[model samples]
Target: MKKLTCTLLAATLAGTFTASALAADYTFKFQSSDPAGDKNFQVQQAWADRVEKMSAGRIDIDLLPVGSVVKHTETLNAIKLGILDGHITATSYFSGKDPAFGLIGNTVGAWSDTTQLLQYVNYGGGYQLMTELYAPYGVKFIGGSTTGVESFVSKVPVNGVADLKGLKLRAPEGLVQQVFAAAGASPVNLPGSEVFTGLSKGVIDAADYTVFSTNQKAGMNDVATHPVQPGFHSLPLIDISMSQKKWDKLPEDLQEILTTSVRDFAYDMTTQLKIADQQAVKEAQANPNITIHNWSDEERKKFREIAREQWKVFAQKSPNAEKVYQSVTKFLEDNALL
Candidate 1:
């Protein structure tokens, strides 16, 4: 009886130690600027799942949707303060702090295709500059995902730049808003959650939100009759970032895994969004109440012209902005997009 008891006790001790060894060493709370049910959020969740599995459960991330842990605009500060472990957020949301962020966020009318912009960020010194911009805030830029050309959903048809005049449009707070205002439109600053209600209640006449797919998912088609095609205003870049302190605490291998996972996620998301946007455009066209209009190339050129001026104004806002602006302009020039 005594020998059997000793063996059982030894076995129990080994089992406890094994279980503890297998448990995740690090757990991060990752918050996204997308609400639950949105494709962006779904992609984020998948990224988290992939990371956990790839890490062999060494690192676990809890993905939270928009406003679940903190307000979307507050994510940067939260990460900096270590109140949040990480965030997947639109960089432009912080443009008020530094126009450099705005330059990195979209560079309105800069790239006709999302992949072009993605290349600029991944290979054109964009990631380095963005890292420098976030360094002061104690945050690290891990990676970013891009949306295809955005849609300009409107209650009234916008055949050209002239149609924007006096129209109340819900635009983000950045160069996009400034450019829209420059085009003679009244730009209202509203969160993504407020956009649908704003359009439905007539608080705003139009909104330039995410791609056609996300807009459709948000039910924009039900309220807006006209959606401008070949969207020329914005192609937002959503970044994944972590607190510098927390990042430094991670093992080197874990850090590599996290960053590589995010980059892979970005690539996957771009392809998924492109396909999804195509489907959404098709669905919107089939809706009897929805009318899709494509702005003439000349009109697109005019909008880009106005946007260029606004970019200059935004660059002049800060030294950092100038630096980011020069980098992006050089990239465009190199690619002959300038």
Candidate 2:
């Protein structure tokens, strides 16, 4: 009887130790703006996995896709209320809160590559500006990523700035629409859902949408025969952020792990998308119905010049917008991008 008692006590002690070892110190719930199958969202999941390993399982992130807990646009508010621990989303979704978000969300026509945008945000003043923009809403901005430069879709060939003269195209509202209009193109406001229909029915000639592989996969290339590669305009900013309150509870080392990991995530995402675009271009070239047009450096410069003029007009929308304009322009000028 005494032997049985000792065995049971030993088993109980071992079980307790195992449970204690497995229990996590922190488990964060992050909702991604991308759908479950989206390439970006998958990379986000990998990022979470890496964080768990880095923290030795003390930190575990449960990453959910869009609408898993709340609407995508509502995530900003949800995090403030502590309903969500963090989010991976486009800052433009909250542009309604401040014109600064609008300008910083996507500076439309400011970036031609992923490295330039990431450099501006990381080493330049963009990181500090993002913190200021988010803190007022109870969120801590971590880092930013992108889908690289988005390719343009058009049924007719648009080779240069000359082709934009009076051309009718579908574009997102605000800065993108305004920039296109300023460049002498007639910009139409249309939802993303209607882009294929609008293009197929001859309602518009071109649209500023997403990356090349995404468009090709969705049959966008089928209807729009002419696609401009190495797109000249619109590289959006995707933000990774957390509830400021929750972030304050984390240890300093954990905080650094999350921040540095996100920066690495951006580099991973950019490279993967670039490879996807290259493969899609190869497939697209094999098809006789499609024609790829890559803009020349000279043509891109002219369009950027037109875009810069509209930036000045948007800057006057609010005080925050003005600050963003000043910061962005200073960065551009310092980098010789101006």
> 1-338 in candidate 2: lDDT tens per residue?
99999999999999999998888899889999888987888889999999999989899899999999998889999999989999999887777777788788889889988888898889889999999989888999999988789999999899998898788899877888889998889999887879999999989999999899889888999999999997989898999999998899999999999999989899999999999999999999999999999999999999998888888898898898899999999999999987
lDDT of candidate 1 over 177-264, digit per residue (tens): 8889999999998877799999999999999887888888778978998988768788888899998998999999999998899889
- What stretches of model 2 exceed 4 Å from their correct place? none
- Model 2 accuracy (lDDT, Cα): 0.90
* Colliding pairs, model 2: none
TM-score of 2: 0.95
- Cα deviation at 55, candidate 2, in Å, is 1.1
